[model samples]
Target: MAHWDPRGQVAPHVRRQVASLAAAVDELVVVSTADLDDDGAAFLGRHGRLLRRTNYGYDFFSYKTGLEASRPEDFDEVVVCNDTYVPLVGYGEVFEAMAGRPADFWGLTASQRVHPHVQSFFVAFRPWLVGSQAFRGFWGRMSPVSDRASVIAEYEVGLSRTLTDGGFRFASYYTETDADRALAQRRVAWWTLHRLPPPRRRREWEFLKARSKDPWNPAIALADVALAPSPPRPAGARLPYLKIDTLRYDPYGLGAERLLRLAERRRPEELAGVREYLAATAPLSAARPDTDLRPTPVGVRPLRRLVEYGRAA
Candidate 1:
């Protein structure tokens, strides 16, 4: 997976994720957006090929860079992902589910809100799609820009349109169905009531409820449910769905908490790594003026510690 961090170093959770991916795939290459420190370099170097580049393009550019360096001809399939979400559980199950799918490219989940396209957080491209002119031309025509909106509009949204228009079939692990969408809405409501503080809870509930009727992007809510600790379920819910878009909205750091829990349960040895990471990064996150001002929740002690550290700093 192509990885990027604004801090110019990979987080411990990301390192663990890379190790997991390396175990599943035959070849793994990490294209970092910035120069790695000795530790980052050493960690990534041991697992796979590491390509460091100037932080010019976002994940899209990082993907392109990794593709060019690896030469798509050398591999049958290429998976492009970032360090945005923690694959708490079922990392291998996701790939295993997609193994025999007959699609040019596919992602873990598809979104239809902004446009009909697979969310780029975790996408896999087969050789047929990778070798196509549409894929090559998309990157060839790409111009580096630091603007987030431009990247989303031109690359994230536009790339899907380009490939689909070029007759490349698209598929996803989970397609939004009416039943699941309703489940997602209910999940959002339950989370708002149980998770958020009383003062902010009402406002968030009303806003989410209204949006649930005609969600601009249901994937966000779907992800909230899929990654939630104990997701509420109807009578019989069997299918597993996954989406990992961490950058969009995670004001409470619940994403990190879930990831920490996953590590503690499945991979307890990694807890120290995740704890150290949160202790260091959470303070940086809280220090921003735009950060949520609400007090940290009761159970997320690591985040609370970080808040204290930030206050002292």
Candidate 2:
């Protein structure tokens, strides 16, 4: 697993999730921004490997930084996730599914259910699939600079086209919203705008309201169910269906103490600096941020404590 963070401090929830993942897997690596400074460096050094870089914009920057810092050949399999999505199960089921296929790269394309949070915009795949020339061709056609969003757009379009051309079909649930959570909310909003409380006024108002807003709000599209192509493919370039619920767990924690311990063993001074920064930024803590060291308590600290941590160290 590889993690990238722009901030000096990692969120508490993210820390726990990461910890759970590391415990499940054998090799864990982290790539951070050097801008995190000594304290941030110390924390990462203790918990996992740290690779520092400058913060670029979202989309492209986050991906580029992670890609540039990753040693893909180091592990047999790798998983990528953001701070928001936590793993609720282990990799056992996923691994078994991959048994028949090559392990060059695997991406989780299915979810247990429709998530109501962020929309699941793009399908998952091995980075290389979307990183290929076919994808670049798509990107070249879409965006000139190839930043984050554009890359994502190009990846989606290109991957779909490529997979389809290769005889593989892309599948999605017709009834699902973005990440699965929006479906419910969309239905509620749609009903409120159009439904009449009284039988006397069963006018075209509700339908009209839906028509007016549906075009503008993408979530409204979830009301319609779009099923995947029926019948699994028998030959090359086929999309396979894996039951979403088969996943065992999804973690969302990062263990700070374990991380600290790792750092102390690898780089003592760096670990000290990290603890010092955390202390300095901590509310009512002895350490204070000085001219050189500015502790920024990022995770669970209070606002005043965070401000002081930033001011102290």
Candidate 3:
């Protein structure tokens, strides 16, 4: 969840959405920052089986922390969600879509023009893909977003390139333009010797915000919320048949059954024996992602050292 720093009325709404989502899943793990107050903590405790909080950072750092927290062992599938989205139905469908793929690569619900970068209402993790030190390091390097727009675009492009280089496909349930809207809003929060004059700063923020044409002020929604497609799959990308095995319920014979139902566009519950079939399967593994990469030193010292070595050589 990319949480705002101050506590306010937003807390109650965020809590309700989370509670509803937790009830739908078999096991839930909630990760947030210290910004969550007593009410937030109590709400989360009731819904999540496990809860973790990290160092407070802005939207960028908080997002990076969540990425780092995901492990191959936590669940067969990991769903990354922004706090703003309220899941109306089972997200199990997403995992079912990504079933049998590598764990490291992400399965996302995509939006038009703007790819779902900073926040995704739905993302699924495959285990094998996530087990690489290189992948984790790649994400770690993206911490503390310097430029929101460019950072988002570059990360998605770079991520796609890296995954393709490593021989993996990025999958998405595409969304249309009408389903999403984005707005930008900036105001002078501080002044400094190097900063622009107040009038100029205000004008700049106003122009950008207007040009973006967001449905509401960017601060109101944090430019993260979007309408999830009903049935959750967009046109033209539907497979002939895709199985959505409920890992929590049916583990054994459901794969074949799921495949059969998917072919017919039928929900599993509509089938006669699926419920019984799912109840008998055992839980899957919960393993951590590989973290073997050497951490990169922060700042220009490493670059300076490299330059010195090159000159000496």
Top candidate when judged by TM-score against the true structure: 1
- Candidate 1 lands at a TM-score of 0.70
TM-score of each: 0.70, 0.42, 0.46
lDDT of 1: 0.63
Answer with 2 or 3, whichever has the higher lDDT. 3
Residues 1-313, candidate 3: write the lDDT tens digits: 4443233113433554466557655555566655566666676667764344564333445545666655544565545555533232334444555565433455344322343231233455455556655556666667444553554565644555555567655555422233222111111111010132223577776754444342322111111122222334444222111112222212111123323334224333223333333343223212212211222224322342222101110
Give the per-residue lDDT digits (tens) of candidate 1, residues 1-313.
Answer: 7776645677866877898888988888888875577888888899999888887778888888888887786677888887766554455767777778788898776767567887777788898888889989998999887777777788888888999999988888765557556655444443343344544677876875564344334444444344334433321231233223333234233343453354356445434465665555554442433224355446644433322101210
Which residue pairs does candidate 1 place in steric collision? none
RMSD of each: 8.0, 15.9, 20.3
- Candidate lDDT scores, in order, read 0.63, 0.36, 0.39
Return the top candidate by lDDT.
1
Q: Report the lDDT tens digits of candidate 2 across residue range 1-313.
A: 3344434566443455556556655555565532565665666566666565554433334334454466543554444444333332334444455445642333434222222111233233344544446434433444333354454344433445555464443333222234334443333333333233322343665654454333211212221111123222222222222111111110101222433344345435323344543444355322211112223234322333211101110
Instruction: Score residue 97 of candidate 3 by CA lDDT.
Output: 54
What's the TM for model 3? 0.46
